[model samples]
Target: MLRILFCLLLAAPALAAPPAEGPSPLWGMLQVIFGLLLVLAAIVGIAWLFRRFSMGSMLGRFQPARVVSGVMVGPHERVVIVELAEEWLVLGVTSRNVNLLKTMPKPAGHDAGQPAANPPFAQWLAAAMDKARKRQGDGDK
Candidate 1:
């Protein structure tokens, strides 16, 4: 046992020294960094491919079902209005479950052949402001 201990003490320093045939520290570090960068680039490339291909219908261009509107009632709960098959459905969604609240008919003037006529809020606001300014200018004159 004493001889074995002595041999181990002598061999420890030899084992601790790096092997001369192995890569240098700087080269090993560079390889690790390049490997990590390659992995990162692969991940980003996959994401870009998914986006380019429009995977999982994520672009919202051709969904058969869509959320018309939603309102948050709590941190993890919402009342969502969904449109499906030209019918509107109100749903109560929480973290635990989704419950159907009501089924509503499509609103009047929402003709199947015509797109919705609602203008963007910014455009509507600008028109209203212009009308108000004209009114004020006329009153002042």
Candidate 2:
């Protein structure tokens, strides 16, 4: 019985010998990294699904209401024209509140098929430069 007890004590120490150095620090870090990656993947997948189904119009590309034009009135305020549901609205927008200033019918001849009345600033600048160059050449001749 004494010999058996000693052998049992020795066997217990061997059994509890720290589990073969457990897991390395690198293995633990890898597990944490993989877990974070999995969480990120889940978040991205949910966002993609939401975008694919067009669940949130504010986040999606298409919108029923759009800003036709806007101009800054103050440092933090803007006067904006919005087009919605075939009606035009002039709104006073500040950082704190948005107020409807006026409502008007959609303007005639404002069809999307019509080209803009004014070209971009860059094009206007280029045309002015070309005219100046032509004038300079004419004066030289």
Candidate 3:
């Protein structure tokens, strides 16, 4: 057992490449760029597929028949909003279940024509979500 451990430890040193064989910074950067391009291509392909299926476009439209709303009263319980049509969808979002919360009007000085940045309240909501995740993890442990 001692001989086997000694031989294994000695052999492990030979597994790594020599300093001379290491890749240059330029080569590493090129590999990163290549990876990024592949990721962007995949995203574009998925978006194209989404557009082809007209799912995103269809989801933008709200259907009255399937616009039922209710409280999600249990752990992992979720509010589901569905749009019934040729292509149906069920969106499970906690925010949708709690739409009764007061909403402030959009801040002034921000042009309605241009898209607005996320409100400070959004950050607070994110912090609240993080707290919830931590609480859930604590409960599990």
TM-score leader: 2
lDDT of 2 by residue, 24-82 (tens): 89999999999999999999999999887775665646567777766665799876778
- What residue pairs clash in candidate 1, if any at all? none
Clashes of each: 0, 0, 0
Residue pairs clashing, model 3: none
Badly placed stretches (over 4 Å) of model 2 are 1-21, 24-26, 37-62, 113-141
lDDT of 2 at 31: 100
Candidate 3 residue lDDT tens string, 11-118: 987986765767989999999999999999999999999887897678778555443333343565543333334222334446335333322333456443353334
Alpha-carbon TM-score of each model against the true structure: 0.45, 0.47, 0.28
Alpha carbon lDDT at 13, candidate 3: 70
- Order of quality (lDDT): 1, 2, 3
- lDDT leader: 1
For model 2 the local lDDT of residue 42 reads 100
> Mind sharing the TM-score for model 2?
0.47
Q: Write the per-residue lDDT of candidate 1 for residues 27-125, one digit (tens) a residue.
A: 999999999999999999999988888864766576787677676657998767677887888788999999997887878766554544334423544
